[model samples]
Target chain A: MIHLQNVEKVYQTKTIETVALNNINLEVGKSEFVSVMGPSGCGKSTMLNIMGLLDLPSDGKVMIDGQTFEAYSDKALAQFRNQTLGFIFQSYHLINDLSVIDNVELPLLYRNVNRKERKRLASEALEKVGLGNRMKHFPTQLSGGQKQRVAIARAIVGKPKIILADEPTGNLDSVMGNEVMDILLKLNEIDDTTIVMVTHDETMARKTHRLVRLFDGTQVN
Target chain B: MIRHLFLIIWNQKRRNFGLILEIFFSFLVLFAVLTFIIDKYNYYRQPLGFEYQNVWSIYQDTKGAPKEEVFATQEQIRNALKSFPEIIDFTFTNSNIPYGSSRSITSLKKGDKEIDADIFTVDEHFASTLGMSLSEGRWFNESDRAAGYKPVIINGVFKEEAFGDEPAAGQMVEDYNDNPLKIIGVVDQYKYRGEFVKPFAGFFQRVDTTFAVRSLLLHVRSNADAKFEERLNKRLDQIASNWSFEINYLDEMRKSTLRETKIPMLIFIIISAFLVFNVALGLFGVLWYNINKRKQEIGIRRAMGASKSGIGRQFVGEVLVISTLSLALGTFFAVQFPLLKVFSVQAGVYFLSIVVSAILIYLIAFTCSLYPSVQAAKLQPAVALHDE
Candidate 1:
């Protein structure tokens, strides 16, 4: 579950003050599947980042599981991020240096899970995503779609409370993108995991149970 | 945890090992040079035959003197020296100051008991002034200097060689070209050669010449100040204006004897410094590269709840792993340093140098890694995510 009240996100460079999100308020209950659709620079990813606790809003309060996170320390933020949310980035952000299993095991490593059990659970997570046979392969050795699957496996390996996909199919072909979307739908439907996906693809956004549209840093009609 | 760090360092050895070895080599060179110089200093510091603390010898640069003072005139010289309280004793000898490293050689035969010996003409005061004492018989006295005194005080080695199992006192030995000389006393060996040079039987005789002695041995009192030397030089200058030589104290000679080795030692030091510099350079570059390459990983780690200093410690731990491995390698080689002597000029202390170098190099790496790791820790994780 996630909640935002009057959230505003701003990016400031030396000579520019760009607003990414302005006075946006939204909530997603547990096990809900939500999609954020926007054109370029519309804060779709920014909203997803705030929901995932990957970035802080310039103004507003964020509450997760009935606890206010707006005042959480950086340490607490990271702890919550590691324990409560899984991220599937558009580029698959799978560590090129690690094997598939090792990449999946990374989140658990930070959780101080025992190494053996971490590997076992990571393997199980990979098996659920149909990447069990490729656990030893590096991200570079895998195709783009396979790499995304590997990243997906990495995300759910620790069994976090929520999964956030930021343009998960942006780098894949339509068929591969559909396959990735199928995987997300299966995770949400079967495991009762909350899913929030950000995408520009209208059809993909339409397939989700609910949609939030943004245009020029503000939610649209 | 340590094992994982080791694995990480191992994986990056290609990027870091050369610098590690370079630093190690530099340290090795420094240690080697320092050890060598210390050993040489010890060798040069060994005691020699004469009194070093309270003895100074004055040499006149005259080719010859007019009818060199006979025994009677030498008495006048002796009486004049007795007037000076600072002059403990005085000797007029053709040559025989320890550490002079100059020598006069001849063979002697006493009824076919042939032997070789160092030959120097000395006066009665030569023994006491130079802190030499009579070991058996009497030294050359004013009475023994009567133009034909054949008394000889053979050095200790002559006694050993001429009478290996027999006593040498009162024995008769004749110089190949001079009259038979009577063995009076046996003097202790004062090496003119290096400490490592073995002793040999040598001849010693007092030659009566018509020419004046080229040098005078002045055994000054201890605690003599600098003014005393100036005063002594002034007095000697009054004796002969044309006689422009030097007054050399035994201690000064001993110190100067090491002067020749100083430049070589300095060269060794420069070479060692050069090595150390390069080693530090190599280590610095490697650590810099490692920090930059691992920037994103460090970002991810920070994002995962690791503190800034925690990530810094991770890199430091990685550097230490590489350093420890290099030190281990260096130590193994260092243990063979003594054995390396057979094939090396700087062999004896090779191992000592290797270990010293290894520690020094690793320390340099650690210091070099600190700043970069700190920079890495301060890197914003949000900023890194945007960096691809």
Candidate 2:
């Protein structure tokens, strides 16, 4: 489960101050697949980042699995992110220098997993995403859809409970987008993994169990 | 983790080749400078083998005088100098004084080995005047000249080279024309040249009357100074006005001899320091630029789970690996010097240079990588990912 109470995000510059997310409260239950839909500059990604603990809210208490994380140190936050949450960026964010399997093994590396076990787990995760055959291929050598698939494998490799995807299918074709959506749906239904996705597509939003819309830094529905 | 770091370095080898080459050349130059430093240090620690304190040399122009006049002038000078209580001892010779420039080499054979020995022709009092210590036999004496074969006293280095494991004092080695010369005594060490030069085989023979004595070495008392030298010169002039002498203190010559190596050593250190500094700056610039270029990759790793310190460590580890690869190539060539005995320096000194250079390069690489690595560590994953 994820909880955000009185969440406020402000982006300040020398000339102006912009409120990315105004005082709002929201919660997503365990294993629930939720989509946040918004137009450009509507604070959809900012809300997702706060939920993922990648960025802190200007004023809010973030509670995940009955624990508050507002006072967590940077190291503790990173550890929580590694152990409890996984991320899939709009750009895939796969390291081009490493192969697909090696990219998947990144999170486990921080856990001090031995090399052989990391390799085994990485291979199994890639297989789960139907990317076992391309495990040795680099991100540069893959198509946009395959790269996103590799990113998904990386996110799920450590078996984090909460998966935060920010426009995961934004760079892919319709067929590849549906394929990725199907994987996320199956993970939510079968593995009981909680998912929060930020997207602009109506069809993608309709596929999720619930939709929370944002317009100009406030929750609309 | 180190293996993974190595793999990353390998993956980026093409981008890192220039850095590797820079470390390679820097390491090579560092090794050479270190070897020269160690070699000179070892040589400087050895004793000069004779006391140069209170000793001075006088070069006389006897070529203008007739043989009888030259002999008479030298005898007159000797007697006059002996009368001065400040003058402890004096010997007349054609050339070689400590820190004085004159060399004569002769080849002498011991069994099948032909040894080229530095020959110093001096009178019976030359050894005592120079304060040379003997390890085996006596200095040149009156009985040595009349003992049949020509008498020669060799230093320990020459004795070891010409007569290994055998008694050198009673042995005889043949000259180039196959004439036998008896080794009368074995001196400990006779370093006439600067300390950087290796000790060579030396043969000191008694100065014969047939040869003209062109120089005089005086062992003056501790209080001897310029006034005494001025008075002695004036007295020598009175004895033979046609003969002009140039006086030089042996102590000053000794200091100048050390200065000869020190100046070059300083220049070498400055030049080497400049070169290493340039390499360090280049390495820093390259690493900083490379880290900026890899921000996205770093961001991805950070998002996945790498800590800030982990990122910094990875960057530093990559530079260390590249430097290690470069050092490997540089050291391969360096090892050949000791193996081949190139430059005739001691092998231990060369080995020590290799170790010192390796440590120096590692330190340079680590220092150069530090700031860039910390910058890499401070990069925010979300901001970096968003930019990409």
Number of the predicted model whose TM-score against the real structure is largest: 2
Cα lDDT tens digits, model 1, A172-205, are 9999999889999999999889999998888888
TM-scores for all predictions: 0.71, 0.95
Top model number, lDDT: 2
Error of 2 at B356 (Å): 1.0
Shift of residue B277 alpha carbon in model 1, Å: 4.3
Pairs of residues at least 3 apart in sequence or in different chains that clash in candidate 1: B27-B357, B116-B202, B117-B202, B117-B203, B118-B202, B118-B203, B334-B351
lDDT (Cα atoms) of all candidates against the true structure: 0.74, 0.88
User: For candidate 1, what's the RMSD?
Assistant: 7.7
Candidate number achieving the greatest DockQ relative to the actual structure = 2
Against the native complex, each candidate's DockQ, computed on alpha carbons, is 0.25, 0.63
RMSD of 2: 2.0
The clash tally of candidate 1 reads: 7
Which lDDT value does model 1 have at B126?
77
Q: Which stretches of candidate 2 lie over 4 Å from their true place?
A: B64-69, B164-167
Model 2 iRMS (Å) reads 1.3
Per-residue error at B90 for model 2, in Å?
Answer: 2.2
Q: Candidate 2 lDDT, tens digit per residue, B251-335? A: 8988898888889999999999999999999999999888888898887777777778888998999999999999999989999
